[model samples]
Target: MATDAVKKYLEDTNRPYSCADVTVNLRGAFTKSAIQKALDALSEAGKIKCKLYGKQKVYAAIQHDNADGPSENEDYDTPIKTTTIELEELNTQLKTKEASLKSLLAAPTSDSARVQAGEIKTNIEKLESRLATLRDSVEVMSADEKRGILESHAKLLSEYKKRKRICSEMIEAMLEGYPKSKKNFLEELCIETDEMVDFKLVSFQV
Candidate 1:
């Protein structure tokens, strides 16, 4: 949805985009890695200006005004918005997980199992509803707003990617010829989105 808003802004204002600029436009949070990915994507497709500014890189919408700093990637775009393309891709992720979540409905041979299946379905439905709401909100933000959110996200992602990369390289060197690297790698990956949140009700004794 932020993607759509970004596209619309670019089309209407004919403004060039940078990762920071896009972040502001999308108003959604993205990690530094995510920003880099988006910047690389837009750069490759000829949509934005991405340049290395000494210590850091600068990004902006393409063909509007060139930064005085040296340019690393010369890419700009037409009216085509890859955000739409991205949404389709994200949709595939949801679809792939849908079956896994829904697969619990197999006729339960036990009463407890039947309740478990119902509980899973209920949780799944709630998750879906929250996702739908967030998606719609993302879709509706203005390009400037989107850009701000993206900028914040990019800042986060940049740090995250740097740390992850370092951790991975260190692991690679430390664990050379050692087994279980795959598990470690996955644990690292799942640290953010894979953890299950648990809650409980308890009576406090006074």
Candidate 2:
């Protein structure tokens, strides 16, 4: 049976062997699962000693001391303990790396961010183009044009004042013996002046 074969190998070697080591050393005499089961059974039966070195189970033959000295297996315990502690620290670091990877996976991908950046850039370019067009379309008055406009405004204002004075004088003469006051007679005639509607005539300066 494979269990007998495994047990014989352990007793003959009289040294520690992990399941993987035994599988390789056995040269395909037994499948890995069969060797593992055999190792477990032998350890449970106290036919061999099993110690866990980190995540791996190592089996050794049960040592018996001779009358001359202690068995060699007695020397393995200290090194195994040190190796276990180191493996535990490595496992902790590996777990931390895995958590970081998971968090990165949950966030937005680089491709998506690039696509959004491209859209924002396109919108900004369009707005800049529109602003440039509006600036170009606006008309700027030259100094000569501004002066001409001011002169035209002054002339029209002077003509308007002259016409208003003439009309006021004619009205006053006609209202000399009128029953109502001049202001009242003007209101009855539904006449509106610039001052009545709070209108201001402002002069332009070049």
TM-score of each: 0.23, 0.46
Worst 10 residues of 1 by lDDT: 197-206
Over 17-102, each residue of candidate 2 has an lDDT whose tens digit, in order, gives 88998999999999999999999999999988898865788888876654546544456677667767887899999999999999
Q: How well is each residue in 89-183 modelled by candidate 1, as lDDT tens digits? A: 99999998887777766545588888998999999999999988988784676878777877777677678768868876876686676667656
Off by over 4 Å in 2: 11-21, 24-28, 52-57, 63-68, 103-113, 128-206
The list of candidate 1 runs beyond 4 A from truth reads: 1-21, 29-32, 63-206
| Candidate 2 lDDT (Cα, 0 to 1) | 0.86
Query: Which candidate gets the maximum lDDT versus the true structure?
Result: 2
User: Residue 200: error of model 2 in Å?
Assistant: 28
Q: Would you list the C-alpha lDDT of every candidate in the order shown?
A: 0.60, 0.86
Number of the predicted model whose TM-score against the real structure is largest: 2
